[model samples]
Target: MALDRLPAYVRKLRNAAGEPVYYWELPAWARPVKDEKTGAMVPAMRNGKPMLLASEKLGSDLAEVHRKAQLLNAALTDWRKGAEGASMVPGSVEWLFQWYRKQARFTSKKAKTRADYGKLMDMLAARETKKGAPPFGKRRAADVDAAAADRLYEMLRADTGPRQASYAMQVCRLVWSWATRHYKVTGVKENPFMGMGLTSTAAKGNRATSRAEYTAYRAKAVEMGFQSMATAAALCFEGCQRVSDAFGYVDPDAPDRAAIVWEGYQPGVEITLVQSKTGNPVTLPLFEEVPGEGGGVERVPLYPELEEELARSREATRSATGPIVVEERSGNRYVERRMSNVHRRICDAAGLPKDMTFTGFRHGGITEIGDAGEDDVRPVSGHKTLAVTRIYNKANAEKARRIAGARRRHIAAIGALDEARTK
Candidate 1:
């Protein structure tokens, strides 16, 4: 191979196989500088460290190496001009994203949440407007009005799907709002992603799981050697708890990524827990006071079915002080993703609805309380607001039955006397 004029700073080396390898190391000028105000080192580029792309990425390809080297050289020139000349345009959607991601508001989110948002952001940043036009991300954030947001949404809807489009826009709206408040990004007067009336086709993705479906699914789960899953479902349904809160979750922000323990359970008394999402403390009594046959109040098991399942699980795992929802195969706590896969399989085998999910079980529990005419469900569901709790409360047969009973009583009191005529 003839040694041609290669771009500056792009070193060519020989691998063990005697193959030519290209490596790019940051020159002193392209390295990070300490901010005078914050006294912290910030890089010129997103990842401006030495890279082994010569051998690893563009291995043995001289032409491609030259191309990448040119790009790096260009990046170095841009860094010399500072933030205004960087590839990420100032006041652009991508710029806002970069700014937002560096802040505590975005960094403090759950690892999974940050990952999900990052995927959406990358998609938005990469999606081209036309055959060769720049992506939507390059456009100034202030230029994206409500109408422009809608246009972008339609593009996403056409490219992806309704649910995904809606989700992407929702994330966009969040980023925009954060920028307006904290970053105070100039030229961005309002958040266009807001009030776009974006409706999701999968709005009911987490539909309420009926009691019959819950029972059938539990039976199928146990039959399929997933007794732990069945018990976990019971806990979610009976306690109206999120899977992460009930079984614990892998939280990068948390110390040691703690898992749920059985220390809070007092047999035949009460169970206490703090919700992972909201940090709302919850204490559910084992028994509830209900009207007895003789008229006086009597204590009955609040969730008899869940109680039975817990008793069985406790007996099976006697002296174990780990997670309450353990995967039987591994004897470890169930991660929500794997648990969801297993739940889907069980639902399929049980002939349950395709949309039925572990989340739906929690939705069902909250709906059950609403159907039973509970005035305040926050204490039971551990919801922070009435509005949020209401989102899970779906119309059901129990609610209709109550309404019918109320109508009958009203008719009797009014002396309509139309029962014989109707018959």
Candidate 2:
């Protein structure tokens, strides 16, 4: 390939190992020199080394190599400008983002959360002020008021979907909140993304598994020889727990024993653990009438059907410990995605709606308890707040009417008893 035809400053060099490598060479002024205080060489007099572009070592195709080269060149250009003290303005959105990434608020996020936030940041970085204006990242942070934020949110929702737009707004709100408390950035008295009423266009996930639907799905699972999946479904509904927690059991010998454990079964058996997502401690009873407060018997019954399925799973696995749900072929614990596939297959076989999900079992169980006038279903559902518990309850007008009719019947029974006593 001709060097002249390639982007400027992006040249191929032969490494000491006699392999071709592409590198983006810095200008003389931008090149590293020894720091007087540290007595160490740094790239662009910064803490990093010179940029290495695509190479045969990367094993990327030609197009990907070229794309990476372009990105590296853009980053080098920014570095060179920074070296000349002519980089992004101090109070610009780009500068704020750079600072935000270094803060505890951003760094402390989980790996998955950070990755999602990174995608949102990339989307913001690619956005323009207007159709052909400068990149949104380079715009002044102070210029983003509530109205401007709303307009940007509307545009993003239209361009992307509601979920992505809502997430982006959340990221923006976090950055702005941190800036308001820490940095004295101008025109940021309050977070612009706050109280925006940005709603998700996606449908609400309020579907609950009906008893018939669950029974059909379980029958299909058994017929397909996926007894483990049937066991998982039974646990989710009877235990009133998420599928992840129901199937996340690990053996004592496993490396992640500290994170997940399979507590052995006994009468009034319960698995006491902290939820992975919410960190809420929950005690899931495997049988009815577990010991309750003040020596009163609280009914947390394990249905006969669920009990039978669990026994079948135990007999099939032939193990007293380890994950309750395992692939018959591999005899290994099911990952989250595999468990999801099991649910999807069962749903398909049962002729259930596509939107019917494994989580709906928990929702259905919670709603059933709620309909029975159980004031507290949080112990079974492990919801952190009553509000969250209520969200899972899918009771509608029909359920309300049934409860009203039951109340009237009870009142008539009381009247009959009183008239008989008077006579």
**In candidate 2, which residue ranges exceed 4 Å CA deviation?**
1-95, 108-115, 128-135, 138-140, 143-148, 184-191, 199-205, 219-229, 249-262, 266-302, 315-318, 325-351, 370-423
Candidate 2: worst-modelled 10 consecutive residues by lDDT: 51-60
TM-score of each: 0.57, 0.54
> Per-residue CA lDDT of candidate 2, range 1-423, in tens?
432455655566676887766655555666656544323343343322232212223222444455555554555565445422355667777677767777788878864466567557656754654753566767788678898788888888888878888889989998888888865643456688889987774567858987667888888998999998887787677557776677763322233632223454543454554455576545544444447887978864345566678778778878777666677766766645456677788788789989888889888766666655655555555666323354433232223234323333443565687899999
Worst 10 residues of 1 by lDDT: 47-56
What Cα-based lDDT does every candidate model obtain?
0.67, 0.63
With a 3 Å backbone cut-off (N, CA, C), the pairs that clash in candidate 2 are 288-301
Model 1 clashing residue pairs (backbone): 22-54
Deviation in Å, model 2, residue 12 alpha carbon: 23
lDDT of 1 by residue, 239-338 (tens): 7888777667544466354444577777666666557666645666665456999999987555666767777777766735766777676566655566
TM-score, prediction 1 = 0.57
Model 1 CA lDDT for position 257: 47
Model 1 residue runs over 4 Å out of place are: 1-93, 108-113, 132-148, 174-202, 256-260, 266-304, 311-319, 366-423
